[model samples]
Target: MKRTTSSKRCNYVLEKLKLHYSGTSYCNCFEPPWLCPEVEECVWKPESNKSKQFTNAVNTWIDLSKKTNNLFIKKQLYEWLDMNHANILAVDRGLYPVERFFPLEKKGIFNTFLGRIIMEILPPCKNTKGKNKILHLLSKACPKRCQIRNLKEIVLQYATEDDQTYLFLLEVMKKSLLGKYNHCKVQLQFEGRHVFYQMFSYQISQKSFFLKWFENGNHQIFLFFCLKEYLCDAVRQVKTVYDYIEKHWKWSIFDKQVVKSMDNCRKILNTISEREYNLLHVSDWISSIESFLLQVSKQHIKLFRTTNAMGYISKLKVNLNKYIISEDLNVDIRQDVSRFLWEITQRTTDKNVFYYALEVLGLEREVVEKVKNEIFCALDYKMLSPNDLFTLKEFCRVIELHKSTYNFVLPKHYYDKQVLSLKKRENKNNQAIGYICFICNDIKFFLTKLSDSSRHSNKLARGSLRVVVDNDISCCHENNLKFVCGKKPERHVKNSKKKWKNDKKALTRKLLKEKQRNFLSKQCIQTPLQEIDLLGHAIQFNNKMIMLCSSCGNVCMLDPESFKYSVNINCKVCHVSPRDICIKCNTETTCNKILVYNQRRTKFHKAPMCNNCTNVYAQKQPVVI
Candidate 1:
């Protein structure tokens, strides 16, 4: 979660890629760095569109140069652009650089349109059309610097068919399909001329990942993600000389020289701060602080060097009590103040202190100036981990110590976006007010409905209130907050508690008494109930005649003409002929069959089978199921 300096991270990439050893990690002819991961991940994504265009532009020039002459370049078309250009960028900015590949000696012919295309647009190359089979171009030069030679004999120093740099350039181009930075600054030796690209690739997971990272990841990109872990541990120390002057020397309030010089120093601090900050005054303010510190050093030369001079240690605290700054000074300006304070404390009596500081800062300015000008040179600003309170304290501490190198000038706001997406409200009361639940997006209280609605979002419920800023759902409360929620304001019920009184109440009681009497009368009559008994009947098989048998009343299967009467009647339930027993017991039923039960069989059981027979059959047959 901590961030380190951009320099340290860049160095890590260099070591990790093995490019610091100076031999190529790419070329298979040499041993390479460790292979990259299969997955793609980088501190900064490489898909800068300007970079892709630069890549494509290089290939276009290569194609143009390769074909400029099956014949000599002087006779080919140059003034007339080939209608078949493969570059997506058709503007003059893209074409001008590639056109520079032509010979400068023929500046006279370039005046004519056709002559320009033939001699100036196309590289002045000679096609030997022999075993050499190579394209050669004349290097363009100023008249004062070069010895004259025939156009065909002039040669580019590095451009050659056999140059190994082209192989590296081609492989890098193929990997450009993934992503690249806006300023890759690639150079390749072409067959006819040198090609310079404004951008290049730095994808760390490609086959040539190490080459790209080592070449441009630090110079072109300054992403901080990679340094977060490192920065977490880089402890910040801010040294100040004022503590040494006051506590260690124990200078009294009556010291005339110290008091008078301190007042002049305070005035100078106020003078520089009265005006706005500009980096141009950086050297001027450093000179002033050095002049003042030199005077103090003259008085305490031995003491100053001997003891690192009463250096006091303090941890970063969030609660700074004195100053609250307005937003105008900005975060970046505050960081510059902290940086200036730290450097001022480092004994700037030697001229090299200011000189070396500016030199180092100038180099940093060159690095990040492309994105946001580091003209202010806000180095080590992150060390103090500034907050509003901390920044204001540092500002005062710098002023108090006569330590501002800026005088009043501040550093550049390199990364401040200052996004202003919202309209500012002029008045608190006039500001368009809304009274709504963020979860429900509703202005009114619907207790039951709110209980039913989903708490996560407002759109899912039917009865949920839709809060609209312009709508006035109800009168404002005593506190002027819109808390009222009445569906129909005119007829809305207010909670009321009172005893009920009406003539209808007496009539309602009388109606209830009559209904109770009818209910009691019905209940008494319904108490006496009846029960019915079921018995088996005899069935004659001869004529399909069915009759109830007087003997035991069991259904019997008999021929009607056997004796012109039913005989040998037996009930399946009772299992007795001309007899009755209790069916529940699996015995004969006597007087009357009570709690008559019907026997139902499984589909596997036979029609005439009893419980005992069915069980015996199931065991013997070995049921399929």
Candidate 2:
């Protein structure tokens, strides 16, 4: 009968053959004979079968010897073994060589080396076959079990290398792993090689599938731990790279692709937990970078027009304010950030620059004099006229709101002073005229009337207890007697009846003469009264109107008796009266009292008291006295 052997039996035979050649043997003495299928197969092959058996035995021995010999090959074929063979070898020899066959699976060489170093320092299993063995073991081990010290040591070892290529590879590996993990704990030492390595590593590592796991998988816990490890490893390196770029790279160096890539990276970083992703103090580093970029942007603003540059600057200002005011950052760092923003404002010409500077000053409570001076010094006053600059109403509003903090000096004040100086120069060319009284307060109208009368050849008269003036005075009512005078009083009247008789005769003659003169003057010069709107209020030159408040000491022009007593009247203080007397004091001295009114006037009338009196009365208590 033909003999058959199971694959496991065949494998057992082959393993035994290898041991036997090396002077070792396995004794399965107590096992059943049926299990020894190789022995049965050997017995079944006889004669011609004997020749085949000898050949088969020799070939199996040779194959086992060759397998042993491959372990020491200079270019070990084990590194190139297929997955199935590698898995089998991993089970037999352990995971060390197996990882070599799948080097890309373990992050990268840098990550693998780091994994091995960790294993060496706090090894999962002490006797690893090679560096790759430790990596393979770490991959299978729980992420929480991974020691932070070992990760830090691996990063430091490779990061310490001055070689650009080695550093680049190290960074690439770190970035690749960071894509998958959010909270890595590696500390990258800053150097030129390291920065370049990090940038390039980020460029390449974004494409890794391990990175996709964090993005695509539902294993939130696993994803978080992986991300933690990666961020811990990459944050310091990323900051170093950005710092170098900010200082050394020009704006032109940032093409759309690079900027887009940077934005994408930022977005991805933002998506991760801030606590975990901040292992390298990346927020501080990014703030520094933003500050540098803001400076560059401000310096290059001349390359763009005012409007376009303003748009760009607005975004920078927003980012800058966010950084400066972020409570998560240190106070000193925020201060520095604020200073940098101020510097950016100084270099910019856009009007919004000052607005942003104002906001910064408001936020930081900074003295913005330097920024203001710089802006004014660099501005093209010729290009932008005073009026044009003033047209930025929003800027003016901001200045008004924060002028104290920003130390904003009003431009209008300076302009007015300049204009006054010019007016003085013009006045020097003209001769002095008669003094015109400056009416500051209560007697403005009377002073204006006196000045007008003096300009004409007007005569003066006396009425009741007051003196009045007119052109060619007539109808004087002094001591209840009337008299007409073409000139100043020469003598006093003794009899009241005779004074009235003489005044009537003189006034009649004066009126006839004045009418003739007025008609003649009317043809040459229009009457000043023609411009006055007489329909509203009747002008009364002489009336004994008593006023409770000195401010309301003018005659009531409205005829209270002509219309009903409800007729509205404006008082001397220009207040509208709802009632006949002062609404505030409720004093009935005269209807000429000042009245208060608003737009909805025929509405409830407010009291006619001054603001000061009202305030005092509101706070005062009635005295027993």
**Every candidate's lDDT:** 0.27, 0.30
lDDT of 2 at 156: 31
TM-score of each: 0.12, 0.16
Taking all chains together, the TM-score of candidate 1 against the true structure is 0.12
**What tens-digit string does per-residue lDDT give for candidate 1 at 1-625?**
1343433433343343233223532212111122222222221112344433334433433343334443222112111111111121223233412221212111222122222222231222222222121111211211111212332222112213333322322322221211111111121113111111112212322335434343333211111111111111111111232233335543222133333433344345334433322222323332353366345434431211211222121111111211112121222333344565455555555533543443343333332231122122223332323353344344334333332121111122201110110121121211112222211112332121111112321212222233222234353233333222222212122321112224567555444443433332332222211111112212122123332122323222232122333343222222232233223234321233222123353244212232443444455553322
- Candidate with best TM-score: 2
Question: Per-residue alpha-carbon lDDT of model 2 for 1-625, expressed as tens digits?
Answer: 1233333433454344334434333122111121211332221111233233222332232233234543222112211121123322233233322222222222334443443333342222343333443243233222223233344334334334324323343344344322222222111111111232333334434434322332343222222223233323432235554354335432123222223333344443433323333244434233333343333333221111212223332333333323322312222212233334434544665765665555543422222333344343223323432322222222332232232122122244333433343244343212111111111001112211111122221111111111122343243233332211112222243553455566887755454444433322322121111111111123232221111111122222332221233223323232323233434455432212133344444443444443334454555532111
Off by over 4 Å in 1: 1-180, 186-460, 464-625
Error of 2 at 135 (Å): 26
Task: Give the Cα error of residue 190 in candidate 2, in Å.
Answer: 32
